[model samples]
Target: MPFQAAPPPPAPPQAPPQAAPQGAPFPVPPPQWPGWAAQPPAPSRGAASPYPPPAWRPPRRKSGAGAVIGALMGVLALVFVLIVIVGALVGLSDHDETVSPIAIPTFSPFPSREATTDTRPTRNPTSEPTSRPTTRPTPVLNRTAKNNTLYRAGSLAKPNCRAGNASIYNHTQFKALILKTGTCMGKAWAPALERVGIDWSPPKYMIAARKGRGACGDYPSPGSNVPYYCPSNSTIYASTSAMAREYGPLGSWNGIIVSMMAHEYGHHIQSLSGISDSWWRQTLDSGSRSGKLALSRRHELQATCFGGMFMRSIAASYPIDTTRRNTLLWAYSHLGDPPGGPRDHGNTRSNAAWFRQGYTRPSAYQCNTWAVGSSSVS
Candidate 1:
C-alpha cells in the first residue's frame, strides 16, 4: 500500500479564459491575482479614483496665537464698557454737590440799581410845508475855574433846610418826609446852580420796593439802601423801605437823612455842570481797568464832596451837632468800596474825609475832589 504512487494527485483544476463582454472596446487578458486582478481598468489616465480617496482630512493647524489674540480683544471690549459707566456716575455726583442757594444780607443796602424805555407812536406823514424850527441845545456850564462849576462856586449863603422830623417809620409818612426835604434841597441848589451859570431843574423823586423800566434801562433790586439817579429821565429812585428799615429803628437822624439826600442832589449838580459827561467821556477814552477805577473814584468822591457843601450850607438851619456828624461820618465810611472789591468808589477814610472837607469849609473850592491825585481819591 505504501509503495503505490498514489496515482499522481488529480491535476489542480484551472479555469479557462473567457472573452470580455462582446461590445468591449479593448481586449481583456486573463485574471492574474485573486482580488486585485481587475481594478476597473486602470482609471482612464486622469479620471478620479473609483474608490473614494481615504475620507479627506486637512493638515492639523496651530491655533495658539489666534486663540490668545481673540481672548485679549474680548477683555478690552469689556473694560471700555466699564470705564464709560464709571465716568458718567462720577459726573452726576459732582453736579449734585455744586448746587446751592444764595442768601441776601440784611445790612446790604446801597446795592446800586444799575437800569429804561420810550413808547412814542409813529407819526403819520402830513402833506404840509413844514418849517424848520430854530432851536439850540442847552449850553452846559463847564467853563468855570478848574473846568468845574462847583470848584468855582464861592462861599454859598446858608440855606433854610430846617426839616422837621426825627424818623418817620410808616412808608407813606417817610415818603412825605422825603418830599418835604427834597423841596428844601431844591430851594437851596436852584439858586446856587443859577449863580454858577448852570441850568437848574428839580429831579423827579420816587420811593419803591423795586423799580423797573427806568430811564437808565432796568432798575436794580431795591432795599439794600442804594439810591439811583437816572440821567436819561432826570429821576432819583430812592428805596424808602431800605432807608426806613435801616434808619427808622435808630431815632430821628435828620442830619443823616439830609446828608444822604444831598449826596444824590450832588449828582444833579454834576449833570448840570457837565462834570458827569466829561468824566464818562474820559472813562471811555481810557478804556482800561485801572483807568476806569480811577475815573469812577473821582466821580463818586466829587459827589461826596459836593454833598458836604450842601450840609455846610444848611448847617445854620439844621444844626448837625457832634453826635449827628459822627453818625453821618459812619454812614460815609460804610458807603465805601468793599475790601478787595472793585474800587469804583473811594475807601472809608477818603469818603469821610471828602464829606468833611465840604462840611467844614462850605465851599465848592474845598470840594474839588476831582482836582486831587489818585491817592487822595483812593
Candidate 2:
C-alpha cells in the first residue's frame, strides 16, 4: 500500500518437534492429518467393496535386494502420498502458492493492502521490454509543445527531486539521479515524463507530503496501502517500504515500484491538465441521489493509460526493432488490466489496449478517454 502503515514482518515457520524413540514413546496424539481419517463411504452406498478406495499400490517387488529396495520405495511412496494429501488443505495450499506473474508491484492499492493473496493488478505484460536510458538524459521524446524545456535542460530541466532521500537509499544502484524524499515522483522518471509532455516541475509544495511523518509538506504521510494524491494538499504519498520487505529481497520489486509511481504520477498529470479538479467538482455536483460516486471509469482508466505512457517513454529509449518490445508489451499488459476485484478497475484487455494506445500514439490529446462512445482512450 502506498499510503498505509508498514506491516510487521512474518515469523519464520517452526519445524515440528522430533518424536522420541518408540520404546520410550513421545505419546503423541494420533496424527490429526486428515489422511489418518477413516475413508468416507463411496460416493454412492451401492458401490463395490467394504474397503476404502484402493491405496496406491507400489510396483511389484523383485527377489532379494530388489525386494528390500522395493520396500524402501514403498515407504518413500507413502511419504509422497502424505505430502500430496496434506497439500489438499487450504491453509497448507496457501503456504506454497506462487505468484504467477514475475513482476512485483512496488505497493498494493490502498484499499486492497490487506489482501495478501496473488491480487496483482490484472496484467499480462510482455516478457522483456527495452531498458530505459542511463542517468544522463537523452532527447528521444517526440514533442509538440512549442516551448518545451526538456530539450534545453536535458536531465536538469525539471526538478521535483523530493523522494530522493540520500541518507536512506543508494540512488546509483537504482540508476535514478536522485534518492528518496529529496525527490517525490521519481526523478529517474523525469526523462519519461518529458516523453509524455508532463514536464511541469512539481514544486516544493508537493514534496511536503511525501517526506517522513513530521515532514508535514516537507514530506509525504507514510503508508503504502492507501496511496492518494490530495488535491487540496497537492501531494502524493506512498509507503511501499513494507512491500519492499515483502518482495524486494526476493529480487523483483523494481518493476512494481516503477509501475505504481507511474500511476500516482499519472494522477499528478491529470491534476496538471485540470482533469482531476474538474472531475471532482462534477462528481460533487451529481449529488447523493445519483446512482454512483464513480465519477467515471474513464478517470481511473486514463490514469492507467498515463501510466502506460510512462512505461512506453521508458521503453522508447530502446531502438524500435529491439527485443525490449516484448518487455514493454508485458508491462503494458499488466497496467491496463483489472486486478480482478471490482468493476471499478479495468481488466487486462482494456488495460493493454489503453496502454498500447498511449504508447504508440504518445500524446495527451490522444489519451482523452472520457469523450462519448470512445473505447480508443482518446
Candidate 3:
C-alpha cells in the first residue's frame, strides 16, 4: 500500500483570492467521458481486464513466439541426439570382438577348412569426438525487466472520468470517477502516441492507477488543488473532491481539464521515450538549482504542450462545430492560470503563452522552455 503516502480530507474549495477574476467566462461543458463512450473493443490483460473490453484475438491462434523459443527448442533436440550417440560409443568401447582359431569340423575340399585364418586388412580405430556433458546455465532473474516500463490503466469509456452523475460522491464513486477519467485520458492520447511512432501496446506497459499516493496515488499532495499526473507512476488519477472542485465547479474549462489529463498522458509518453528518466537523473546532479525544479518545470511545460497536441488530434479527428470549438478554446483559457497561487500550478502568463504556442505548433520540441532561458517564462 505504501508506494511513497491517504483519504479524502477537506479540499479548500474556496480559494478566496485565487478565484477566477470577475467577467472571466466560465469554461463549462458536460462532465467528463460521457457515461456511454465506447471502450476500445480489445482485451488489456485478460477477459476481465482493466480495459473492460475484449481484444481482437486472431482466428487461427499462433502456438509459438519466435527466434528465441525456436533456438531453445533446437538446442534441446540436438542434446537428445548427442546423448544417443554418446551411449552407442560407450557400448562399443566396452565390447571387444573376439576371433579365435577354433578347431572344428573340416568341410572336406581336402583340408582347406582345417587351417584357414581369413583376415583381410587390419583396420585401425580412430578416436571420434565425444561430447562432454556440459552444465547448462540458468539465466539470472532481471527485476528491472518486470518494471522496465510501468503504466496504470484507467476505466475506459465512462462519462466525466466518473461512474455516476451529481447524485453520488462517495469513495467508491470517486474511484470509479478517477478510473473513468484516467482510462479516457489514456484513450485520448493513444492517437498522438501512434502518430509520433510511440508504442503503447499493453504488457508493453500500463499502471492500474490504484487509489493510492505519490508514485501511485492521487496528486496535488491531496486536498491541495485538482487531481494531476504523477510522473513516477506515469498515471493521472481523480478523486471525487478533485473532480468536483475542478469540473463540477465551473471555475475552469472541461476541455482543458481533459487536456490536463492528456497533459499527464504526455508525461506517460515521456516515460516511454526514456526522456523522463534522463531528466530525473540529470536533476539529481543539478546542484545549481533549488532541488529538481528545473527538470520538473520542463516536464510540466512539455506536458501542457502534449495536451495541446491531443486537442489538435481531437479536432482533426472530428468536426468541432463553431460553439464546441470555442468551448475548447475557452476551456483552455479558463484553466490556464489560477493567479500567483501554488508553485505546483503554473502561473497565468506562462500558462496562457505556452497554451498559445501549443495550439499553434504541437510538438515537444516546440515547447522546450529550458532552451529559451528561465526569463522567457515571465
Candidate 4:
C-alpha cells in the first residue's frame, strides 16, 4: 500500500438534535473553562443524572502546635481590645467627675390651655356655690351654763332699742314697751347665741288682764306675782293684775319694768341654751332641800346678772342714765329670798352684787354665777 497518512480516525457518530417538546424550556449550554473538561448538561426533571458520584474523603486533622499558636494570638487580640475598652471607660469617668448635671424639662399630664379648646363655661372666682352656706348652723343645745361657750362669745352687740318715755302704768304703753324690748332682746342676743352654737328664737308673750292657765300651770300660782317662762311652750305668761299687785307703784318706772322683763327673758335664754334643762336635772338629783335651794339661788342670781348684762349692752342706745342704773340696782337689792322664806333666791346683797358685776363686765363670763362660791351666791 502507498505510505499515505492514515485517514483520521472516523469521526464518532452523534445523535441528531430533536425539536424541543411542546411547552418545554430551551436548553442551556454548559459553560467552558480554560483547561477543565466540559461538564454534561443538568438532567431534566425525573431524569437520571449523567455526572459521576463525588468521592468521599477523610477530614483533615488540625496540627496541635498550630492550633495553640492561633489560640494565643486570639487571646492577645482580645486582651488588647479589653485594654482599649477599659481605658476609654476610665477616661469617660474622669471627665464626668467635672461635668454638671443637666436639668430635664418636666411636662404636666394635663393639656395646656392654648393647646386644647375648652367647651365649658367660665366660673367666677368670687361666687360661692349655693349648696354651701356662708356660716355654720347654730346648735340646738349646749353642755353647761357655768363654763359655757356663751362666756367666750365676747361682748353682746348693742341693738337699736328705745324706751321712748313709755310708762308702764298705761296698759297700752306697757304692752308696747314689752314687745319692743322683746324684739330688741332678740336682735341683740341672736348673734351672741350663734357664737355659742345655740339657735335663738324670740319667746311668745301673753300679757293677761287676769290670772290664767299657762303651759306650765296656772299663771299666778300661790305667792308668785311676776311673769313666768314656760319652757314647754317657750312663752312668757304674765297677769297684769298680778304684776300690778306685786310691783305696786314701782312698776310705773320703765327701767324697773324693763329689768323685770329682761330677767324673765334670761330664763328663756337658759331654756334655749340647755342650761335650764341641765339645772333642773341637777336640782332633782340634789335630794336635799338645802342643796336644791342652793342650785335655785345660783340659777336665779344668774338671771339677774343676765338682766344687768342686757341693760349694759343697751346703755348707749336705750340711754340708761345714772338714775335708771341706780333704780335697777335698788330693785335688784330688794328682789331676793324673803326672810324665813324658801331661800330659793339668793340674798339681797348677793343679788345686787351679781347685777353690778354684770353691768361692770364686758362679757358673759362675769355673769356666770354658778362659777362663784356658794357663799357668794347665797
User: RMSD to native for every prediction?
Assistant: 42.7, 30.8, 38.6, 34.5
Tens-place lDDT digits, model 4, residues 142-253: 4586656666666688998877876555667667778889898888778988876776788999887777898888887767888888899999888767776777667456
Candidate 2 local lDDT, 27-61, one digit each (tens): 25534544466777557776566677878988875
Model 1 lDDT per residue over 111-153, tens place: 2222001123322222122354656666465643235765555
- The alpha-carbon lDDT assigned to residue 333 of candidate 2 equals 59
How far does residue 246 in candidate 3 sit from its true spot (Å)?
A: 2.8
lDDT of each: 0.65, 0.46, 0.47, 0.72
TM-scores of all predicted structures: 0.58, 0.40, 0.45, 0.65
**Minimal lDDT window, size 10, model 3:** 1-10
RMSD of 2: 30.8
Question: What stretches of model 2 exceed 4 Å from their correct place?
Answer: 1-199, 203-226, 245-256, 287-296, 316-325, 331-340, 372-378
> Residue-wise lDDT of candidate 3 within 288-369, one digit each (tens)?
6544664566557666765665555455333334665566556555654346544433555565556656655544455554
Lowest lDDT sum, 10 consecutive residues, model 2, at 1-10
